[model samples]
Target: MEFGEILRLSFAAIRGNKLRSLLTLLGIVIGVFSIIGVMTAVQVLQNGIESGLSNLGAHTFQIQKFPVMASQAEWLKARNRKNIDLRQAEYVASRMTHALYVGIESFDNGETVQALSGEKTNPNVTVFGENPEGISTNNWTIAEGRTITAADDRSGNRVVVLGKDVVSKVFPRGGAIGQEVKVDGVRFTVIGIFEPKGAALGGPNNNFVAIPLSTFMAYFGGNRRSLNIMIKAKGPEYYDDAVEEARFLLRTVRKVDPGKEDDFSIFSNDSMIATFNDFTKYVKLGVGFISFISLLAAGVGIMNIMLVSVTERIKEIGVRKAVGARKANILSQFLVEAIVLCQIGGVIGIFVGILAGNLAAMALELPPVFPYDWAALAVLICSIIGVIFGVYPAWKAANLDPIESLRYE
Candidate 1:
């Protein structure tokens, strides 16, 4: 038989059993959809996280009483320990010579405020307290005025820097510099306005106030110790060396023995990424298991449908053989038909899955990502399943005795 005739015969056979063919394809559609959709969504989220992490700046790390990426239980335990106050921060700075800038900052979230403008004051803002060095450490940029100076920090000056949101809420007319905004009843002159930093994985960065470290300690005293210390490595090449120096210095300050684990935690950007990756590994595993289950069911459905097709076409096979049709021709026709069915279903499923994944990502406020490699793998898997499951039925039909098949049916 010609190749054209073989293809025509295959389509005719499929057309003869439309309901059965659709039922077989349905399993494949569901299986491909489940895996492809999840993978696309994961890809997008991973990209967003990496972008946020990169924004943390280069050659910088933090040393604190607590780890940067700890669970709630670990955080609670760390909070209960002795605070790593400003004294410890000073000690680390005095001892460590590798770092370029060592900044100490302690902050309280959700601090309510009263922004007064002749009785039209607002009361929804967050306040932060940090030294001059916070500018480089947090990669914050000044939009209108100067950042807090060293003299400002030392004098405990009641000066404040307004975030973009604070400026809009308190000074809607746009000239907020040198204006006064009250925080917990203490007045502060707005020294600068920070450009919007947008939202980070931690939360919104444009809803807070930044005051001098001394002013913060005096106004909102919490053991006069440091809540967190940010250190900038001298250069990218010396980041590891700086971390080691900081660690050694902190251990010495904490009076930790050389043989014992360090009491304080040192966290770098790489460590943060590793922590996030570990957390996502379990989610990936769950997705893989569910996809596996669906694929297995689809494979079984494909095999069962192929066997039925073989049985229904027994008489046709005998007739073709009587007319000198080769066994190889019969085998090729059935094999190609099975593969085409699966490939079609897989193509449709992949497109639909990607659409669904992108929609879900948008709803979650994440960027959309297309996983070309995953889609290609899905297509390859469908083709492989077709060949593996279609073989038994094709072989049986090809080997049937023409005389017996024709006589019996």
Candidate 2:
């Protein structure tokens, strides 16, 4: 038989048993959808996180009382560590030789900011208490006027730098600089507005307000609260050296015993990315295991359905063989039928999976991903499942005696 004749017969066979074929297709669809949907979403998050981690400027890292990435289970231990106060941070900064700039900062979230005109922002605004150096460490660029100067930080002056979100909400008018905005009932003179940083993994990057570190502590907490000491190296080559220098200085100043671990945690952008990757590894593994089981079950369903097809078509096979059809031709026809079934399911799964996966990206404001590699892999896997499960059924139909099959019901 010609290849076209075989394909036509294969599709005709599937169409003949629409309900059964659909049941088999359902298994394949579920398996492939599980794999593709989860993988595509994960890929999107990975891209967003890597970009978001870049919020920390190059050659910069932070030493804080808490780890950059930690679970709630470890929160109690982290909370128990002694606070890295401004006094201690200053002492370390005065001695750390490798760091070009050492800045101190702390923040409180879920506070409201209001303009003098009574225009107010949502209660979700994050207010950062930052030194002048800390402002630079945050990668905040001045779009208008100027950032808080060292003078503003020295005397706990209530000067502020507004993120784009704050400015939009509090000072919607053109003039934001020189306006006074109240942060948690404390008034601060807005000295500058930082260019919008867009959204990050956690949320909007430009939805915060920054005041001098001293002002933040004076009003929000106190000078004794834990501070994140931001450190910048002169270049990438000095990055490690700067961290080590800061660590040593902090330990010496904090009087941490030599044999005991330092109370502080230090992390850079590279380390943060590595931590995030480690977290995602388990997610992928769990997802892969689940998908594997689903696909395995789907493969079994394909084999069962193909065998049923062979049984129901006994007389047809007998007639074809009697009409001089070769065993190879019979085998090829049944095999094509099985393959067509899987491919149909695979195509549907891929389409639905992409749509479902990108829904998460839409929520996070991340760009959609095509996941070409995964789509191709899904297709290849479908073909493999078809071949692995269809072989026995096709071979059995091919080996049947023409006379016996014709005599049977």
Candidate 3:
């Protein structure tokens, strides 16, 4: 018989056993759905991190007391290390000739801030103590008024730059500049407003106040350790040299033994991104393992159903063989039926997975994603599963003697 005739006969058999066909499809559907859903969600989060938090412009890195992502053992070791103080930051800045800008900042979180105009008050604001070069290093654009100047740092002036969130709440009257806001009971004049930078992996970027390092040290006290140094290379070509020089200078300043590991951590935006990708790579592997287990179960189900199908159509198989239907034709018919069933399940699973995954992404505030490559792979895997499971049943149907099959039923 022709291939088209065999395919039509396979469809007729499936339609004749509608309930059984649907039951067989259920296993494959669930297997594909489990894997595709997880992959789609992970892809969406990766895309978001790459676009929003990955690269801090270009050729920029930070020197901090602790690594961005560390284990408990590493954290304990880092905690024992001496803090990156402002004095050390200044020393490194002065020695680094290849750097275009070097800025130092210290942060105090969960401080209460109140604008003392009338009775209106807002609380819980983050405060940053930074030098003049911090504006350029952080890539912050002044939305209104002027940025902190070198004179402000030298004189220890009580001037501040308000972030978008702080400006809206503290200075609701439209004019935030020249106004005084009390930060932890210390009053400081607002010198500028920063442009909105949106949310980051850490938290909201536009929800803090920036002040001169000298004034912050005086009010918040300079005794606190833990300073973050931001450095921007002169150009992309000099990025490696700048980082090497910074590391050498810092090690020298900290008086580290040449053989011993440096106590400080230095990392760029690219390093952070690579760390995140490494973490997600494990997640993908885990998901794949789980999907494999499900698919294995589904393959067993397909085999069982195909075996029963051969038994039920024993007399029909005998008639086909007696009427000149070749064994290869008989095998091909059964195989096509199994493949068609799996493809049906795969298509449904892909659709459901995409919808479910996008919904989860929306809940997490990430953009929607469609995993096309995974979908194509799903279809291909389903076809392979069908062949593996259908082979035994198809062979059994093809090898049965026509006279014996006719006599049995």
Candidate 4:
């Protein structure tokens, strides 16, 4: 039999039972959509987070009471351990010879600020306490005026730096530089304005006001000790050694026995990424298993429909055999029909899946990413399903007895 004849018969069968074919394909479509859309969103979020972390500088790492990216319970447990105070930060700075800059940062609760420039009072800002090293440590750049000096930190000077949004909201006309703004009635001269550093893993960067750490600790009633210390290695090659040395120093300082785990957490961008990747591995595996189940069900449905088709078309098959059509021809035609149905379903599913995933990413305010590799795998699995499920029904139709089949009603 000619290939054209086989294709025509296969498509005719599909066209005749349009609703059943569509229902069978629905399972495959939903399964593929769920898997593809979820993974795409996950991949996009992962990339965005990694890129954000990368902007924090690979040469820098932080020593803190807790891991920066752990769950709440773990974070709380770490916090309950020995607090690494300002003295410890100073000690680490004094001891480490490989670090170029070591910074101590401590934050207090939100304080209200009233910007009074001839009754132009703006009162919505979160104030922080930082020093010269904090500027370089937090990847902040000054837009106007200079960052707070070590002299400012040492003398507990009441100088403040404004973020871009705070400057806009308070000054409006760029008149904030060298102006005095009062935080809880303690006046601070605005010595600088920070350049816009887009949102980080925490929140928008433009809504903060920074002052000297000494001033914040004295007037704002915070624990005078530092909760986090940041260290920048002198060079890229020295980063690993710096981290190891810092860990050893911290362990010795905290008095952790050699046989016991360290009391504090040392974290960097690499550590955070490793933690996130470990978490996502299990999630992706579960999604893969779920999608496979749905695809299997769809395949089974296709097989059942193909079997019904063979039973209903027995007389037609017998008539074709009586007219000298070979069993191979009959088998090939049915198998091709099943595969074509699945290929069409797979195509539709892939298109919808990609569209849904991208739309979801936009809705969630994350980057859009295509699951190209996973899509390819899904298509390959669909094709395999077609071949596996179509074989038995195709064989059943091919072996029909012409004499008995033709006489059946």
Task: Show how many residue pairs clash in every candidate, following the order shown.
Answer: 4, 0, 0, 0
Task: Give per-model TM-scores.
Answer: 0.85, 0.88, 0.86, 0.83
Q: Give the per-residue Cα lDDT of candidate 4 at 327.
A: 90
Ranking by TM-score: 2, 3, 1, 4
In model 1, pairs of residues that clash are: 85-225, 85-226, 86-225, 86-226
lDDT of 1 by residue, 195-298 (tens): 78745554544878889888998898756555677888888888888888888887777787789776777777778777777877787779768876887788
Note the residue pairs that clash in candidate 3: none
Q: TM-score of model 2 relative to the true fold? A: 0.88
Go through the candidates in order and give the C-alpha RMSD of each one to the true structure.
3.3, 2.8, 3.2, 3.6
Q: What is the lDDT of residue 276 in candidate 1?
A: 77
Stretches off by above 4 angstroms in model 3 are 1-16, 48-55, 118-122, 314-330, 395-409
User: How does each model score on lDDT?
Assistant: 0.79, 0.87, 0.85, 0.80
Error of 1 at 150 (Å): 2.0
Predicted candidate 2 versus true structure: per-residue lDDT over 274-323, tens digit per residue: 89889888987898788778887898999999998899889999999999
lDDT of 4 by residue, 192-272 (tens): 999887454445447778888888778876464446778889899999899888888878777889999878888788888
Question: Where's the lowest-lDDT run of ten residues in candidate 1?
Answer: 118-127
lDDT value, residue 318 of candidate 1: 90
Candidate No. with top TM-score: 2
